[model samples]
Target: MAGTVRKKMSRFNSMISLDEVSRIVKAYSWKKLSTVEVETATSVGMIAANTVVATKDFPPNPRSLVDGYAIRSAETEGSSPADPSRFKIVGKSEAGKGFYSAVSGGESVEIYTGGILPEGLDAVVMAENATVSGDTITVSSSVKAWENVASRGEDLSAGTVLVSSGNIIKPWHLPALTDGGIDRLTVFSPMRVAVLNTGDELFPDAPDHIENSGMSSMMALLPWRFSNTLWIGQVHDDPDDIARAVKESSDRWDLAIITGGSSLGRKDEVPEAMGIAGAIEVFGGMRTKPGRTTSLYSLDGKPVLSLSGFPSTSILMADLIVEILLEAITGVSGYRIRERLPISSDITTGSGYTRLIPGTLVEMNGRTMVAPASSNRGMRLGSLLNSSGIIIVPEWVEGYHSGDLVEFRLW
Candidate 1:
């Protein structure tokens, strides 16, 4: 049964580039995803299913930016310390309150910061620039129209797009959305994921129980509240047991992540189990170092990401690949924070494989730069701990010299 399964999935046995993986992922026919309406305040990390536009203008009315006297700009023209302008004080305006009467020629209204601009008032003169007495104020400086006041609809206009479709909601976006009168947002529904850890040595109750760091790290890196996952715990290296688990998970979860048994080792049974469970091959291998054995398969329309059993490799693959899979399934492209910085030292990579090197950002010579965290690319879990981001070297490039600018993706 294992041999037959291998033959069926062997067409993609050769290594493929990440570009090919992207093409295949984009071309896959996925089922229509449902959208949910969530409160704008709590929608951070959710993918926007539709564009959110402002319902009304922000700063609904013109308001005072500083505590000053609201007056006609023409009244203060040519006014200075030597030749001042005087006006009679009509009334005071506070925030959320406006003067009921309009300020005519030779009249001023005392207005505080954030107070609604009085009717017929087009400018404001700072209190320090005006001398106040009983019902009279003298202005020593000239004022311009609409100066020191927030104009209506200046911050955000009605019908302006607050959040575009296929964008992930962020915390900073909430304030603008609320100001734009958006109480709720339409976002893609959260996905259910099942994580399965394989290998006989992974038994937890036994004395030989190995810590499943791969499973723990994968779960931790996924965006909280977005990828709702159920840990299937550990399954032994038996093909039948693995196949049963895969089938059951595929039935219940939107996606499945199986760690271990992806390579051609003697104990590797995940490939055979996937075949038995009627999984179709999407890509067998990738041209990426440390995660070259990372393979993707599909059962029905759901995807399964088969990662290496090695803790470091699995964790890195999860950080990079899971996001792509989620975006593909939800039909929403999420944003990744990345920067291009010059390397502090030289580093070498083999040809024909894209390399992901963990690194830290350092300030040297008054400029921010990236320095390689570990020379060892395999089984270096400590590298991940000390690193702030990943340094990517594409397949076409052989290596990088010191001071060469490269793209870095923040974890």
Candidate 2:
């Protein structure tokens, strides 16, 4: 499958970069599709529309923070635990219930936790702390006004940025929306994407056995991070078959990715198949190491990235290029590469390529260190399984050793 397309093509661009590939693949960039109305409670795990606001102040009313007796400040004066003060409880208040009467100097209102503060009452004394006799609750000690009252809008105001645009909704956010008095919101609707893998040999690796087919995981991770994803399965290495697949699949999806057959191969028909479907081949290579086979093109503005078949190459390409397209298409930015530091080590860089060395990051003395996962590319999973992240060795830099300061990416 190597060099078949390049060998036959009349011309191929001599220079290509990862940035160019990203721009091409992200052509249409997050075309908004139809949105469905969802209940605020059920909308958990969905996206947020513009900023959200509290329709009414959270708690909406001043409520008691504890089960206690509500009373006026002047009435509780000259009270102590030993010489307790007694008062007449005019009425009782429970959660969701409110007392409306204004209290006189010697009277008190019975208030429970979450109960609305009675009218003209300023403070509350705990039920256990006060002694109740007849309709009166004794004041065990002097109380201050507003001491046990939850003020209106204390949790949230009528208007606030509950959530902003471009945020992937989490389950906890739903309660905020509910508290904010939002029944429904205009969230960035889920992005539907098609994962079109092309190759006779590009089979999904055995669950127990891993392969460079990591592209599938890499591709799937994009939608997982942003919106909806559909695995369209693999197409035989036939131009007509591929073209037909692209046209048919494009109807149901917002973005389409054709992996595996992007490069030069006797059976590599993806580029031509895309061309046959009237799609533009933006570029077909990158300057990055472990991913020279990375390519990008688009059909009717939808994104399509071609990743190398090697696991290391596909994973790196997906994290960098495919992830970029996902962000562009869904208006979502994927997680950044995090770092930890371990031991410091240096590597020799070959003259031509920009190398991405697999490494573990560990933090020591508040500084991060980068240790090589391995010099070998095929055993990436070994490093990935226990990795901190890649220790990026620039194009021209030679390497480093122990005690050398290196950047880290946390896993």
Candidate 3:
């Protein structure tokens, strides 16, 4: 409802370009979703709602990274195995304990890994490099300042951002957050999404292949990609039922995706039903192959996507366009890894439309290459399992030659 436009256009002739769709979506005033505070270690798969900064240095004090003797680097500057430097062992430092006395030029402190260094000490000579006998240590090689010693704030300084807003929380993030003294994090609550399949041929037990493909794919992907809680339902090819389902979904869900009945076919009632549901049209269609009928709308301040009935078309549209909308609304980013890689073979696309070809990442002569998948062209269910990524061909560029670098996204 908030980002809706009241304009009308011929679905087939006046389809908007993909660039225009992106511009419009970017211009929309999408507010971030609600947030909840969760323990940092348990927040994986959730989107961070705020930036988490370090409260204190990761290493609160200078500490030893190895079991070694803490000594001044200058004391062993010219020492070698032929004429070794000597130091009198004064005290010992273990984890959670620090040697109180400072080490002078000829003195050293026995220190274990993670032990706080003695005062005035700036380096550690690893145990293997030193031989000790009754309070006397002989260093075989020279030691540099800060060698084997972790300095204060070496890993993370206070005020350093541990995690940024709009980034998905990952497993590796937990240690960083904890090291930064962040025990809890504010993350966006999981968005609730609904997939409404509309086709007269659909049934609960057995459904049309195309319709089931779109529904099942969305069902599996929503949780894995955006972490959205999903609901699946179906309606017959009637304008009233479609309108009712659309309205209900808008009232109860964050986003609703209606597959099938989006094209300008005799049985396609979604366009007319959207009007009945008081949905404001964002765009009637997009200038893209296979998903040219993909449309977007806003109802009650919520996003509603209308995708093609074809399997590959609907799935691709959901993956590309719906993800953008979700990011706009949720402030989450970087769900897929993008790469610029060489193509395994030559490929061509239509002149006026941006083409998305499902592809496989292959190793040709030990280098990863992108090759267009054969099943994707026919929009078969096998395409889903076979393709590992999508190769994007710009609308202006007609084709690419073998070995040409192109952009793609791993699914």
Candidate 4:
């Protein structure tokens, strides 16, 4: 009955599976990185270049790892609490100072934290474990050679791959890169993308109109949002208007995104408009719920991702589709929001359509469960204000009882 109803509607193009669409994007993906020398301080959240070799060997010299008595391992080999090992402290080694004297048979050096290790002294006893007299320190514990000693080049080599390419520089990775003398790096330029909100009823700021225009607000968060998301604004249902916007924007954008008109099930004008333009490739019309109306095409050899106008469908589809395409192009996989949870309540869903529900994941009885929030599709824009992610359930499942594990991604 459902298939019959779907067939009755005009199927302009055959629906393709998610993997098939992914393959098409993979084939069309291209990486043209922009070269810009960014300060190490400013490039904290960007991808790394090929690799950055260490400018100099880390540590550069043997250093003390603790504040204790630095002594030759042989001198402390037979030391014990009953027969404490006594060594004459000839000199003190503070941080940045090199101990020039060599520790002989019963000699030791007083080394502070980070101080240069004295010659011939391979181990150090912690200050708490050793007793210091007027001119000698007694360590009762035995230690092997090189204990608590940081050898030169132990942390980083002179020429090593600090951070490789395709890595999104995180806060933690920055310190290592900067401290390793990688103050400059080559990062892939941001993807050039433009937003084309289709349909005549869609308004950029109108409360009701904007809400109806699918996942429009997510743009402000895109990596290229502030600089490259040419909000090219809205295009009417007219074929000419949509075609012109696609052509004009295609020049400035490596990829153009049109929200709302790709769905031919409704009175959608996007597919028709793209046909009238120079050239395009449509790989949507999938047998999926919420996002089935989504499609992607390449206008004039430039890629464009088309999405349904519904906010729920748009948001969910954007997370999946954009990451898939961009990863192939730039190797950036964005963020993943994970809060392990089960179905809050039993769900009775029919077979043959992939399902994605905007859910409120909560902890109940020491287990997280997802509860469906709304099914309005495009009607509930405010519904996402508190939402985290969509629980994607495959189309083949009969239903899921409360307490089934499902993972979600952040918007």
Candidate 5:
């Protein structure tokens, strides 16, 4: 039965433009994943499930930005070194401890940085700008109203949204969330992915095969790149074995990635096996170099992408397709870092196909320029390591020349 299924699907090969494939993936109605509550410390890199609002004003009260004296601005008007104005220091305010008394005319409160400004005080005079003599502060410079005072709600007000739903939490966002009194956040549960390496030549225990296998590299990279990923082990070129693995993995994981057997050769049985496993072929091929054989499938609404066995091609195709799927599920764009840089040399491409080339940015003549690491070859592992990003050549454009600006998609 499996042999007949494989034979029928082998003849079902089709090709489509990359843009059309992207549009198709985007158009799918993806159900939102379940949510989980995590402590703010561990929430970095997770997508927020709900908007986080500030419960109270940041600084909560007017505070001093410098170690100085809090006084009414009118008292310091027209004061300078030549004609200093002296005011009695009636009290002192420190962080977490406030001066309960208000500042009256001709009186100031000695305050430190982050200290709450006493009542009736609208300005802070730097210590260097004033001379102190036993309970008296002499101001030599005029301070404008609200100067050096971090006003209440200046940083964030109550009910202000600190982070919107679907935003990927970053390290820098931690401080703001902590200050907003958010101890915990609701975030989408990390996607669970299963990688099934289909090939008779590969073995998990064999060092030589593992070193050369794209599956091995993916096992190490996927967890860091996305979320939880499990290596469900490898399979030979048997149609039944591949189909069984695909069905089992799809049933348990949010996504299943099958590496190898994605091309047109006789041994390439992944596309057929996927069909036998009840996966509808979303697309069989992409019009992109190094990864044109890349294919996508849907099993019970979950995604399963079949990638070429060639090492570099598998990695590049994953970057493109997996990122799109992740964005669809998590509502976060994959490329956190992208830049437009000048090409250091000319790159030619076929007019009908989109090309992706690995390259590294180099400093030339005091300007940052991108140098193509190597041609778009599937097995060029050296180029993959040396390159910091991929240089994309669109289908409409034939190529790019030296000094021409191009978009570089960072890894």
Candidate 6:
């Protein structure tokens, strides 16, 4: 049955628009990965598999927000600097140690920051605003009900959802989760990806070629952003060798990426080799500049993305495709940070295709502006090295003029 499905899909050679490709990528069904419980300290960068709920109120009781006196609001009413109201300080309430007695109408409890507000006390007066003498406090300032006091459940109520499922755990989320009584979290295991570099002219050891290879930079970029990626090394531009390398790696890894030989040249056998390896081509090409030859395939249940060999094109295509894959697998979106900044100069694009141009953001005359990086060839590595982000020119829009606002994806 699977073989028949593959055979039918093999005839699908149509080029898809970028929007259609994005939709197809979003609709893909991802295989479930195993989940593991880890300490909150170690869970940063992992996707949460379960929502975390607050076990109790954040403060668990009404607490003082300042070092002062906890008293009934009426006790401080009609008090002034010239004619102050007097209250007998019966006891003190320090943090973690609550006063056993209730505060009466003429009484107040000396309370420190984080100290629990005693029963019948609805306000607090800062110590600086009161005069303390012997066992009595004279308050000249009147406080309203619940003033300077944090009520129970003010920060987070018991049973409240602190963190939603499918969220990528960040460093700032740890303290809140910890305060809500969450010590451990269940998160999806990081996806394992295999990268294959296919080309006949490529040398693994040649310093210049290796430095210029997209595979080398992608190898560093992938593990940092999306998954545990391993470069299975390069294969000669032979259909059979490429097929074997892809098939073997796809079986062991969650996804496979083939860089180089993705274009339509005679030596560009990746798309054909993907079929020979029992993979179904989902899309052959995209209507996008610098990466029009980008292709996606499905081997068994795993996805295999074939990207352009050019460094600039390969980087842009990987960012787009891998983000979709990450969202599908983890139920969380990658590339979360996007900024809209004004273009520093006029930019043009082809009429029928989307254009992705590398850009560097700078402050000019006290305003943030993005300028396109210079590169005569799309294959050059200089543009990518100097760029902090990429400008996305939509398919319908021809271009943008200077001072036009454009959306950019930061690196």
- Candidate 5 lDDT over residue span 5-39, tens digit each: 56645553456777887888888866557789999
Q: Give per-model TM-scores.
A: 0.92, 0.76, 0.90, 0.84, 0.91, 0.89
Which stretches of model 6 miss by more than 4 angstroms?
A: 1-13, 101-105, 204-212, 223-226
lDDT of 2: 0.67
Q: Better model by lDDT, 2 or 3?
A: 3
lDDT of each: 0.83, 0.67, 0.81, 0.71, 0.81, 0.80
Q: Residue-pair clashes per candidate, as listed?
A: 0, 20, 1, 0, 0, 0
Question: In model 3, how large is the Cα lDDT of residue 163?
Answer: 87
> Model 3, 97: alpha-carbon shift in Å?
4.6
Candidate 4 per-residue lDDT over residues 138-166, each given as its tens digit: 88878888888888878776786777666
Question: What's the distance in Å from true for residue 226, model 3?
Answer: 4.9
lDDT of 5: 0.81
Runs off by more than 4 Å, candidate 2: 1-30, 74-91, 126-143, 202-226, 238-240, 263-269, 333-375, 387-411
Error of 4 at 251 (Å): 3.4
C-alpha RMSD between model 4 and the true structure: 4.2
Candidate 3 local lDDT, 1-411, one digit each (tens): 222222222456788888898788766765456778998878888888898899999799999999989999988988989989999999999998889976677999999999998888889999989998999999978899999999999989999998898899888888889989999989887777788888876765555433355677777656653456456578887889999987865655777888888765566577789989998888788888768888888886677888877766788888888668866876668877899999999887758888778889999999999988854345555665789888878888888999999988888
Q: In model 4, which runs have C-alpha deviations exceeding 4 angstroms?
A: 1-13, 29-31, 49-57, 90-105, 158-161, 203-216, 224-227, 337-341, 367-372, 375-379
Q: Mind giving the per-residue lDDT tens digits that candidate 1 earns over 25-75?
A: 777875545678999989999888898899999789888899989999988
Top candidate when judged by lDDT against the true structure: 1
